[model samples]
Target: MKNFLVHSLLLAVLLTNSCGSSKINKTSNPAVPAAQENVSNQAIVPAADQLKAYLPLLKGKKVGLMGNQTSVVGPNNEHLVDVLLREKVDLKFGFAPEHGFRGDIERGEKVSNDVDAKTGLPLFTLYGGNAKQDSIVKSIDVMIFDLQDVGARFYTYITSLHRVMELCAKHNKELIVLDRPNPCGDQVDGPVRKDDKFKSNVSFHKIAMVHGLTVGELAKMINGEKWLENGKECKLTVVPVQNYTHSSIYKLPVIPSPSLPNHLSVRLYAALCLFEGTDISVGRGTDWPFQVVGYTNPVYGDFTFTPGEKAGMVKHVEGKGAVNYGLDLRNINPDEFKFTLKYVLYFYDKMPDKSKFFARPEFFDKLAGTDELRKQILAGKTEKEIRESWQPELAAYKQMRKKYLLYPDFE
Candidate 1:
């Protein structure tokens, strides 16, 4: 079984790499002048200036924008909805993702529908029950999604995109994805979601946990693969970001989500989220969620407990507080780095006081997308051994993802 999993992963990786070279013919080339390209390439101007190409296409269309705070125009931090409205684009509805339109809601908290203070438009909640379906978007001609994705598969924003795309296909409505940079770039990592075991709003389709595609690229992949219900396809239009390469990490003025305030939080989300399966606080109900993980107990050895204003733990080290007990390696060492699966396995192997670490086996199993990660942790497998067990499955997933990638190969 372990050998089969490793082989499947390898095959997927190879397939993904091969698919990067495949290209589809374009029907018609939009007339984008050389001056515009030059202007877009300039570092002084906003990298998102390429969105101007779609202005002619969206001039007078009744549009429903599916976005949040991060959906801004450029360095001026101009709101996309406001820009469309000012341009007489007939902006109708605005859909807010998990953290509400303004990105104020806390994690796991329900966001209620309300009227936007600035635009006076009714803001719909896509995070709640029955909200992520097609029923809410029936009043508009085109649904434009412009949220910033942190490039993690389990992040709710990607799932929100997935459901919105599915709904657009069902309603036969035109879907426009305003492309943004993937902060994590094109580095695929971790395991793919298994078909039979894990399927949720978070893990809807089979993709690596740290999928390295921009939201627009993901939309293209999903449509090209016909991953929507009954193989349905939406009238998709992707407004690609000009001058934006896979290497560029865009520092947008608008916040993507509440918990993910900065690139630091986003960089840590994929690794730290593993603690969610454990009893650790994960710094929820505090200023920094996913930045720190700790519990109330002080009895655990090798760590000193220092209480913060909001019940946190700091290590014995200077300047570092107690609410943080786990590995705090922020800088990714490109030379020494392995895949996320291997990194996670290493962390699990070095975990201190396994008995004190409160992780439900079922919860860990679900979060990891399989029972294998959990079983290996419990079985006391060394990090090397655990990673060796997953190489085959990871390789298979990499190969399967090839045909779905939309960006140039950097690997």
Candidate 2:
């Protein structure tokens, strides 16, 4: 206990001294939209920024933090883990989700149990498919979840959210989700996961491709709907984002993952991510990942880029050692971007060999949350026809979504 206190004090001092009075800009790049410098007059304050509201809850409890690189507080972007330590919150252990504690781990990479070197805290991996963190969940009095979500269903942090919530419910531990603005909170398009066979880590719940709910709002839905094992409900508390509405054009203070480097990449992710199931590369392993899509063939497009390995970010480079040709969308206005199926459809239509287009059909379906989409594209269904087919289910989901919403609706 004495050593831990000493270490905590040192960390606090180091962090405090490092961040004097210099405020970090929302977006480092001048080209991308700035953070919370959106259309709304008020800046969206994340739940983590309001420490007073939640610190009391952890005053004496053995708290466990489930967070990643994006789990930060304020303009200085001090990590919540460090902030909690500074506040003398009895944080027992740290939990890492899909991207690991620092968010360096590659997408879909298996995170293993380890210890956080910085804080000397035991780190358990919740990204492990099975609920192996049962013991960790039981040891904690409360689990604080704070990860930035990109508002896409297949992003996998939400999957980690489900597993953590399930374990919390089973062990009878309180789960607190620190809400952050969904970069694309207003978007609620794409096919809702309806098929049981399509269930995977990516498609954890039956929601639209872009659910448009903040983590806090989604937590309410998860508990309210009784989606847990045997309809179990977690003792959930959601610290919602202040001055945020569904329509608020909030930009992320930090990149959610390594691939989504800028505001534009994050905005385009929902649309381009579908290309993961295809032979085409979504600029993975490149500096501008998710901001461009290309293939080795010159017929794909005039714009060209080469995919290369990025250590800890992407281990296996997709479309490596060859020039890939396709769209360059780094300069597109993020605010104007809307979730659409047209990009993937265009690539599919261009592919000379239809079978090669869906290089990983099963994986594609898992990402889509339904096999119907692949079948629809294969059948050459127009975007209009495809969107029309989703209306009935989408309409029902929208109605159900309203019950759990914590902010004003976009509509």
Candidate 3:
């Protein structure tokens, strides 16, 4: 039986690397984006972002939304945008974050202003600061932010939420945060961003890397902590998730971004993404964008993946068309995940020449949210020593975080 299982696993890995796979099973008739497919609706109660939960708050308000493909309503999997327009919610315009409204764009790819073909609503990019932000805010009385966050500080969705909330506060408009589950639930691990100098599109706040809060909970913290300008809070309301605790495992209803296509990738992302600043490609331009990591040469490891085009498949941005050699990590169980550095330490130590491992320190530092992580790694610090250094900030962050939690906590 063990032999059979081992052969099966090898075959699966071979197929994954063969560039022969397509998106996981469809969520609808024609094809729903792979990210929209949820794992057994029975496992989760309703998310606060559902229209049923937030419709009353939206009624009679001129609503603008900062949402993406993850915002769905009910078991039919109908989009919230569609449901609102149908019910006469008077949604004025739409705002998109990193992945664009439909969630198809690759990581770091520019999403241009466009019209929603289905609703004909004007959509503006919120991935960075939108130029027409002032005008857009003035036109709407209320803004709704509903996106599934992967519970990492640097995931960029929450950063977009921060920027949007800041603008809302400046305009004095009420913003309602429709909460959803954090997939890496209740796992508040990793170092906090030490100071503001490290802020980027990735790390705009000083939260721990894997903050164990939902978007709504984090919004409250953002306000309660006066993490905004001049210590003014945005007029905010957070509709809380039902039947959720800090520890509930949420299978995401949609892919949070183009690269993070599944739970395993999302779990691995916070830990492995530090590699972004190094020479290793995090499987970009390949079918397994975030699930695995490798260098651009065959000598790097035992496995190889040659990326090719598959319609609707998001290719890696850095190593497109490059055959990368590294470990096959498709079998990793998300249930066993934690914020970790063992993988990076293992891979970096194995590389024949350390000089070629890192590409730029600035990008890595931004992702890490501290220069100390980079310095520690370069200084040959063991993973244990690095983890020990995060204790002081982690303790403080945990205390601050406790003040804003809306659900039963893991602690």
Tell me the TM-score of each prediction against the true structure.
0.78, 0.89, 0.86
User: Candidate 1's residue-wise lDDT over 244-294, tens digit each?
Assistant: 555554554555655555556677777767766666544544456545544
- Where does model 2 exceed 4 Å of error? 1-40, 129-132
Judging by TM-score against the true structure, name the best candidate.
2
lDDT of each: 0.58, 0.75, 0.71
Worst 10 residues of 1 by lDDT: 9-18
Candidate 3: which stretches are off by over 4 Å? Answer: 1-43, 48-52, 309-316
The local lDDT score (0 to 100) that residue 400 gets in candidate 1 is 63
Candidate 1 global lDDT: 0.58
Q: What ordering of candidates by lDDT runs from best to worst?
A: 2, 3, 1
Cα lDDT tens digits, model 3, 1-411, are 222111111000000000010111111122212333332334455454355656877788898887777776666555767767778999887777776777766667676777776657777876655678779878899887777789887888887777777777788887777778888976898889987788887887788999998877777777777777777677777666656677777777667666787888888888888888887777766678677778777766878886555433554455567777887878888878788898788778877888766787898889889999888887899999999999999999999887666666677
Model 3, residue 120: distance off in Å is: 0.9
Candidate 2 structure quality by residue, lDDT tens digits, 1-411: 222222221111000000001111222123212332243667778889988878887878999877877777778777777788889988887777766666667776777766666778776676654354667668879878787889998887787777677777778888777788898998799999998798887777889999988877776677667677777777777776777878888788777777888898989999998888887888888888888899998878999999988845556467987899988988889998999998898888888888788889999999999888999999999999999999999999998898777677788
- Model 1 segments more than 4 A misplaced: 1-48, 131-135, 285-288, 296-358
